[model samples]
Target: MNFQKPKVKAPSYELIHKTKNIIDKYSVNTICIESACPNISECFSRNSATFLILGDICTRKCKFCNVKHGKPNIVDSSEPKRVANAINELGLKYVVITSVDRDDLSDYGVSQYVKVTKEIKKINKNIKIELLTPDFHAKKELMDKIINSNPYKLSHNIETVESLYKNIMPGCSYKRSLKVLEYYAKTGILTKSSIMVGLGEKKEELIKTFYDLFNCGVKQISIGQYLSPSFKHHLVIKYYNKKEFDELKEIALDIGFDSVQSGILVRSSYYADKM
Candidate 1:
């Protein structure tokens, strides 16, 4: 395949104004809003969204994400209750909570992650909790705390193929991420991860990633298109069409993923009910 700029589709999704209003009122951050995710409408309209807790600002800057970076805002003690309340009010059954990278904190914000998940469980123990976490650079102690919290599933994204890690996510190492996922898998947790196409990944490399992750014992995978959030961010290299995504989903299933959510508009947490 020739390397050329991919064509971005016109944004066609719609959001329920009330959903935005409530989130704004609660001061919650979300990938849907913060990242301009294409599936925001469909996800939010269905009362599904990944809650961005702690604060909106990230300490590390990733080339393909839209979450604001620099000095992170203060960690709000009130934030956990607010997020849980919003989940209760919105009547969400499966809630995914993520956040801006907060490496400045000594514990890498594990305290806040624990509090948020604990509060959500208090509101509804049956609520499926999925966490998309920072690399933590494979800190065993931090990983222990997060896993001990008993999330329904744990996800640390290997966002691109191994070769492209540094250029795409400067603060994260591909090995560190895989190690995080590997720890969860070995501990009998339902481990999950995500990746994006259109970031100059080759077909064989993506296939290799599936087997690599499977060898780590992960059971869930999410594949989505990589659209640059802005010109300053990473540029899109190729946009695999719907048929290509379908082929990948089949390949992933064949490679041993118990579940696969792969599509043009798919995000790590979009239509997450599949897993």
Candidate 2:
């Protein structure tokens, strides 16, 4: 069955331009632009963005991701301060920081997250900072460093159901992703995860994935329709409708997720502050 794509309101051109200028001034990266996020205009118009630290290049070639994969650039020691400056100039009260999968690094780029969080806090102690991170192979010592940074929330997306892992997220482990979230949750951190639908997953499989996340202590979750980035990327096997998104949200809530955002245009960090 074919489903119509939902409509999104146009973003303000003036606001978007202003936001882009600031981003350019700092010479920083954003997942919004790097991944070609559908909500880029809206987010930019609001002067909000999820900072993409480290560099734009990723180490893993996840079939569903749009972030470029290959050997990444060396860690930019100045990136943390620049990102913090960008947030300060934007006058943001809340910020989300994420990075490309830098599996090439010794600590898997964990120190960068800590540095960015601390730098942001240094500028505005009250500002809430959320870190959407790579799994870091679910290492406790590495995770402990991020936990000590005291971010407002820590997120590691499960991305898709277990049955689809091998094909969709090669070199990533479903069980290890759960262990990442579980570790943060056990430490009393506000841990979160996200899932993408329309990858030919069975409804039962999604529910099972939701339970797996909840059992491992994910308090927040987002479910969104999968749109193929290019002809070369994973094909979108389905386009979930409004009713289906609502059903998923209801199921997630019933399963004890404190917060749930499920819809056609939802992304892990889309409207993250509000979520």
Candidate 3:
């Protein structure tokens, strides 16, 4: 009997005990676990993790994302306390908070983001908060308020090349995302963004995207492979080898990015503490 063809993707890793304990104690949600990110164990074992705020359900159904897509729960007003408690309990000096696109509420669920950051800061004066926010509907003033709150290292992932934006990240606009990065950089924030490979993006297109990001004043960048988390998402076009990833890094640095993380399993928050 013939078996169905096997799909190629990174194998999953075991859980990191310490990180599990922290999550259990404070009830924090992580993108690594919800998204099934392959780098979960390594990052968690090192006590480096990215928090997924606004609950696990996502309002927007992006094909590339692994988070649950459905109508989300009502706003948990006390979530900020729990998030702060988790951060304090983990003793994380550096922390990242990302949320699903919650167009369900007015302000696009930004007030919660602001409240969470403010609460976390109140807990630790010196904690570094990095917010990977949604587009804020591309309104400059809203984006301005979001930035004026002053989180360290503002990042909004562009997610993929321009050609695939329509099909892959429909809720996002390539130009709008670059503008978000540029807006933060212009305001004296250390701005950053990320892009994914293995989405049918050509090398030439990747180079052009790099230049576009540099022109937008992005200082840090992350490049990684796009492995499908489920059968519903777009098929992986190709996975770049380790050498290819290094070559991409060399080109990004040569193009004026201060820091660039390029690897097969790299995610927006992978090894984020070193940045």
Candidate 4:
């Protein structure tokens, strides 16, 4: 069978230019840019982005991610300050912070996430901060540290259904990721999670996954189609259309999710303020 590349709509020139100017001027990095998210222009056009803290290089090579992998450079202590500065410059009322898995670090880069959140809050006490963090290998101390940071919302993407975890995420565990989200959900702050479809997940399995998250106390969710970063990465098994995504969203809402975003371009941080 021939592979049909999914169509990706072009981003607006004004949005690309404006987002580029901010990125260049502040020397800040966004997951939207680094991950090559399909919704970059939409998010950037709204003057919003998920800031990539800690650095661009990831320790884990998730098959779906475009971010570079390998030995990451030293953690730049100034990164938090710069990120805060960028948010201020953009005059953003809401901000999201996410980072690469720093498996080599003793704290698993948990402290950096906390520091960045603190610095951003310090800049403007009213700014709503959301964190999309790694699972921290499910380390108790690290999870506790993240909870202490008290971001407006806490999220850790399950990434894919449990059945596909082993094949797609070599170093991650579905159980551990759930525990991380469950832990944060128990904190009284809004807890969120995300999953990508079209990597060969079944409708029944996807419905079961939604129940698992709802049962774990997660209140917000994002569901989107998986676009393989490159041919070297995992192949997209299928591209779900709008109708299918809408059905998934309805299932999620019916499953007791307080808010849900499900569409081809929906991402963990896309239109996050609405959730």
Judged by TM-score, which candidate is best? 2
lDDT tens digits, residues 1-275, model 3? 22223233433334367678878787878898999998876777667788988888988777889999899998888888988988887789999999988888778778888899999999997999999888877778778777877898789898888988888776778888887788888988888889999889999999999999999899999998888987888888787787888999999999999999998788999888787
Best-matching candidate per lDDT: 2
Put down candidate 4 lDDT per residue, 1-275, tens digits, no spaces. Answer: 34344565666788768767877787878898899998776677788888998889999978889998999989999888889988998889999999999999999999899889999989998999998999998888889999999889999999888999998888999999999989888889899999999999999999989999998899999998898878998998988888888999999998889999998878888899998
What TM-score fits each model?
0.93, 0.98, 0.92, 0.95
Candidate-wise lDDT, in order: 0.86, 0.93, 0.85, 0.89
What residue runs in model 2 are displaced by over 4 Å at the alpha carbon? none
For residues 1-275, write the lDDT of model 1, one tens digit per residue: 54344344433245466677778887778878888887776676677888988788899878888989899877899999999888887888898898888999998888899999999999999999988888776899999999999998898888899888878888888778888889989889888899999999899999999998898988999999998888998988997887898999999999989999998777888777767
Better candidate number, 1 or 4, judged by TM-score: 4
Model 1 compared with the native: what TM-score?
Answer: 0.93
Per-residue CA lDDT of candidate 2, range 60-115, in tens? 98998999999998999999999999999999988989999989999999999999
- In model 1, the worst 10-residue window by lDDT is 3-12
lDDT of 1: 0.86
Ranking by TM-score: 2, 4, 1, 3
Pairs clashing in candidate 4? none
The segments of candidate 3 whose C-alpha lies over 4 angstroms from its true place after superposition are 1-15
